[model samples]
Target chain A: MITCDMAVSIDGYVAGPNQRADAPFGDGVGDSLHQWMFEAAEENAAEIAAITDAGAFVMGRNMFGPGRGEWDLDWTGWWGPEPPYHAPVFVLTHHERSPVQMEGGTTFHFVTGGIEEAVTRARAAAGERDVSIAGGAATVNQALAAGLVDELRLHVAPVLLGQGERLFDGVGRTELTPAGVRQTALVTHLRYTLSRTAG
Target chain B: MITCDMAVSIDGYVAGPNQRADAPFGDGVGDSLHQWMFEAAEENAAEIAAITDAGAFVMGRNMFGPGRGEWDLDWTGWWGPEPPYHAPVFVLTHHERSPVQMEGGTTFHFVTGGIEEAVTRARAAAGERDVSIAGGAATVNQALAAGLVDELRLHVAPVLLGQGERLFDGVGRTELTPAGVRQTALVTHLRYTLSRTAG
Candidate 1:
């Protein structure tokens, strides 16, 4: 299964302004959007577990870190020495870099080609397991536009960020049927199955 | 109580392009987005009843008809002699005209003052009963931005209209807590209470 999961604000923004190492989700925003994962960890254990259950993960360079242009040699990632993904992760980038082996069975392999190449590599690494597309809006949009995603899980937070990077900005029209819906005080989890018949 | 009700596509559009006298929802769009009201009328009787139960309704001039600039004195809305609104209906417009009394106690009162004035008149007409803001996206957004609406009921249709007027285009960051949620195959009805404390 090719699944893509993302946490979006009610206004459909994934991240706010001035993304950096300290403020990954932007300045004043903090982690309030993702309080469901932290504050209600025990209650949302299944959701948290589901997010990291993929055999292989594909993500954009922006999601990996704030580094742009040439790769920052020192910057491993935001998750310190040990990353959460216990499987091979493919990072789509313009500049090529050697695979960075981190603690916990995670390895970040840089893909210079494109989203297709990253997905191809991730699918190969995944083998029998599912290949997950971890996102930063643009990456998810690309994957969705390419029709590479089979399952879409959206963790919709109640908060509204008036302006930011919208998940479906240039994604155009795509058909999805609701497979499941679970709601909590913090966020609403909506699972959708991509209809193969739809363009 | 003040309430705003609108049926929006998955892409957040309330209506499609070339909204005219013949095609209110636009050409080729048909009534597919509101199939629940027609095909499943018996199944959604309560929802249909709730929509027309408003004592007074406030709608934009665009929603009233396709006529622009000067009023076509002959045109008295698309609903023949008797409209669905059994009570007084206030139409917001820059060009004022005498109130047109229709059959079945329905009257189209043109309010030139503004959205606030329209709501005020609707509230007055409603007495103790609820006033509904029947919309065309822009009107709803204006009401939401002005913080005049107390409750927002969204009928989210599964259909995707890629380009059209979005309900939340320039409404800014208004907060809403989910009051209730009901789902059917045709639409997902989301009721929300407008948070007075939120901006």
Candidate 2:
């Protein structure tokens, strides 16, 4: 089973122009949706490190860089000196690139084969633990539509962009079953068990 | 002082089709983003009532309406019989209509003279309590741009809406200061004090 954990803006934007190419999650306000992740970093570290529940992570290339923006040679790691993901991370991209290594036992592997292929590798790397699909937007939707996700936890922010990007922008009718919910210190976490149930 | 409270889709859209006169909360699932507000109705009723130190509410006509697409004439009072908003509410619209009095001291008044005029009327009616502009998008932007809103407490949802009516579409550049942040059982409340800080 794969679970996708993401933090977003009230308006649905993950990160804005203010975000840095090197440290994508820069010192900006608002979109600090994932600040909870950082806050719970150590607490969840046991669960994350044990790999008893989850294994590898999958992300899109766009999330790594800013899509078509100019490249910054030194702008590889989004997280600071110690990136959070302590396991193997497979990023889907078009342009071939070398895998980058960072602190906290995390490595960025750029995969171009396909999403399924990347998932396959991720599962293999994950071993007994589940594979987590951590992403920006396009990647998650693709996995969701392909029925590749088992669990999805979403934190609905209280902000409204009134514009920007959308995740379910172009999807047909779908129904989600709520598995459980968690009210964090700064988030309303809604965990859903996705299934192709025709209601 | 006036404040706008809203829940919009990750696509920047507030309501979908507008034809579904019955439920104008945006796309079908878009209404999912409103789970907290609805739940807050049940759990936080006493708390909301206690802290609702506001004079009246200001919403767009679209929020109150005859809906957009199918005109089934279903008045959408998502908040149940006795609305939580016991105070008077002013709806912004171009058409004229009679006022509606409902349970729990809620009176729905329609205003057409424009946002400023509506604010003037609401502020005068509010006395000491703040004027809350609970909206559907266009209304919030209007009040924010007009420099009439004194505070904005946005509940950023976790969903991403690729498109829809955005809250900050043309808000331009305005300075706002985040005054406080609090987390409840279902939402992360960010209270921002709006100010014309820079001249």
On TM-score, the candidate that comes out on top is 1
- Across B32-112, the per-residue lDDT of candidate 2 in tens digits comes to 556666766766454345345577887777766654343333463556668767888887877666777889888877787
Compared with the true structure, the alpha-carbon lDDT of candidate 2 equals 0.63
Give DockQ per model, in order.
0.43, 0.16
Off by over 4 Å in 2: A17-54, A65-84, A95-108, A151-168, A171-199, B1-13, B20-23, B26-41, B47-54, B67-87, B95-109, B145-147, B150-199
Candidate 1 docking band? acceptable
For candidate 1, what TM-score does chain B get against the true chain B?
0.95
Fraction of native contacts, model 1? 0.18
Query: Which 10 consecutive residues of model 2 chain B have the lowest summed lDDT?
Result: B67-76
Number of clashes recorded per candidate: 0, 32
